[model samples]
Target: MVDIAKVTTELLLEETKTSGHSPLKFICNDGYLYYCKYLVDFDPNEINCLAYEIVSHYLLKVLNIPTPDIALVKISEGTLDKSKIIKNRRLCVNHICFGSKGIDPSEELTEFETCSSKRDYNRILNQEDVVKIALFDLWINNVDRGRFINPGFNYNLLTVRSGNKRKILAFDHAFVFGGVEQIGVFNSKMPFINQDKFHDSDFYKSFISYMDEEEIIKIVENFIPLLKISHKEVIDAAIYQLPDIWKLTPNLANRIQEYLFCEERIEKVKTVILNSKSIY
Candidate 1:
């Protein structure tokens, strides 16, 4: 199980601040930086969101996608005032922020800016070195309700520099399409064969070239254990803190289990991801 004690409001405050419409931050904790979103109180919707983020991150990691380090952590007692709570909620996804050294290659990187803006989109394209970030979103099903306009990118555009060179890093799997049932349909405007034109674009091709299928498979395999361990820890902590409130309903629990453990479905996803050359 993940150590819930490691996720505290004080730690969140110290490591980072809120961005977008939510009270979440890209902060650092326990040696890794994450994009943490805080919820003042818990609700079914919020719980689902938190669950999605954690599970999606795990799945993406398993799929060998370049996602950021992620986890769900609860704020300790009294860290936030009851009055300060936006909706009488508790629990949050403690997302680690990237580009702590401020070497992010995305031209649009900013402090405390919401990702759901056209201006931000323009900035992301300019600053983010990679041309295929949009493709990354499509690959992971990050689209929310078929509305691709607001696909989250704060964590996606992060880059690390090493000796006069910058490397592209991808993270943030919380918003993947399957997480929210409202947007899980595989609606491709074009068929698979014609998808090559989209993939051939300089931006798309370059990023695809950089990622080899075998490498991604290995990364995904390595991440499963880490995710399993983290989920057990988070769930155990949740049960301890709010036993009655956080207990997963039998149906919800089954859904979560299926999402996490169904190997055949995951393998199919892998096959699609590996064989598809187009981003659409």
Candidate 2:
């Protein structure tokens, strides 16, 4: 859990652009770049996707996976101008947002797909990071990376080569627990929720190929304890990260509570972890 209150940075809207609910790059008052996400408009589900981004970012950090540094940021009308608006509304101005510190600009970074296509394993360094991310995705039921529709193109995987050290990083986690597009189906935890997508898609299959049974079980051992977090804790963590002005009706907050922190939700996460046996 990214349970701590983050240092707030005002969005420098001039350098930012329109983006969806997922993490996007923005310049802030500190003269630094951050990959951030926020709740700008009202969605039917009332689930703030930024909650998942912050949660997963910290979780990955727990496993020693190098994720971006996460924080709570602020945006205001004074800082946000016309360029930052999406759908005719300002993007989270006067609201708290979720953000991850940008990877140092001087580091030599490349997207995973492009690097993989170029056989840049020398730069990718550790294959185990790949295993950790794959198993973590299974545990969280993240569909973003290895989607059936977009095979071989993993979003949010970056390879950084800095001086003599090489590393792999996992960034986006907004789709964990299948929270974004198909909340009900993923929340239900039906057996093999996207069976065809994970099985038939080359993207997910490639992740499986990198794993051995030993690593999968090791991750399972570490992952379950984190789920022991209570409903109140999860709700509080998410709420603490949001701006006051960002809308949060009781109904939506309640639904988010049920979907993320309830006992049933924990059980569903366990179910996904158990099913991951087939992944290796």
Candidate 3:
């Protein structure tokens, strides 16, 4: 139902420049603001960027994570053929920022740095925080990806308002699926389990800790219904655009279905979340 015909490269550039990120703005015809990051080289005929953004937003919402808003858009002066344009079909946009506050982490961690670290299985994530983040990732099917490298912040630590303590907002989800280099793996290359590192650094240990197992379960159970709803919406949208999308990446059609229906090891996750929550 995204109106791809309405989008133009010039309009995309204009909206992007205004948003303050890289020179890309995501404006939806339905009236929403989306921050974008171009992964592949920019091209006029390419519409997959809009598709990924739409699906990611939809999935995150389903998982009950505090993600940004999203919608489809049309550009006034696009580079694609005008006659092939479909009204209300084509490009979509994500339009949500948790708040106006910006993040300032004390340390910086790059994608490359994480990958080069020594393998340490004992240094696992705190169960509770992992659960929260995992829930977020699972809903969005951000498989094989990690929270540490999310571009929304300079680092992975969640930020909050100093006065009111409002939930921190993060955006720029255009890279949910594996890119040209790593087709299927989602998480960053850093090892997930590292007990030695966790014990050595209080800050690192605390970051992984959670509230309680019961509390973690509550959060997960609460998100199940939302996930179901989100899955349906995405499936419907993907089905409608299956023909066009298949032409771009045939694997996506099958992957989407597998991700939606896959059986997650929920009980094990609950144990981890509960144990981590007990750390503090």
Among these predictions, the greatest TM-score belongs to 2
**Backbone clashes in model 2, listed as residue pairs:** 96-243
Model 2 lDDT per residue over 145-204, tens place: 655343344355665677665776777676666656654344433443544323334533
What's the best-to-worst order under lDDT?
Answer: 2, 1, 3
Q: What is the C-alpha lDDT of each candidate?
A: 0.38, 0.55, 0.37
Tens digits of per-residue lDDT, candidate 3, 93-153, equal 3222111112333122333222122222123222333345554543343422343323322
Number of clashing residue pairs in every model? 26, 1, 32
Single out the weakest 10-residue window by summed lDDT for candidate 1.
Answer: 94-103
Distance from true position, residue 153, model 3, in Å? Answer: 7.4
lDDT of 1 by residue, 101-168 (tens): 12234332222234244342333322222323333343434543122223322333354544444454
Query: Which stretch of 10 consecutive residues in model 2 shows the poorest summed lDDT?
Result: 108-117
What is the Cα-based TM-score of model 1?
A: 0.47
Q: Cα lDDT of model 3 overall?
A: 0.37
Give candidate 1 regions above 4 Å deviation.
1-5, 11-21, 26-35, 39-43, 58-141, 144-147, 150-157, 182-206, 209-244, 247-249, 257-271, 278-280
RMSD of 1: 9.5
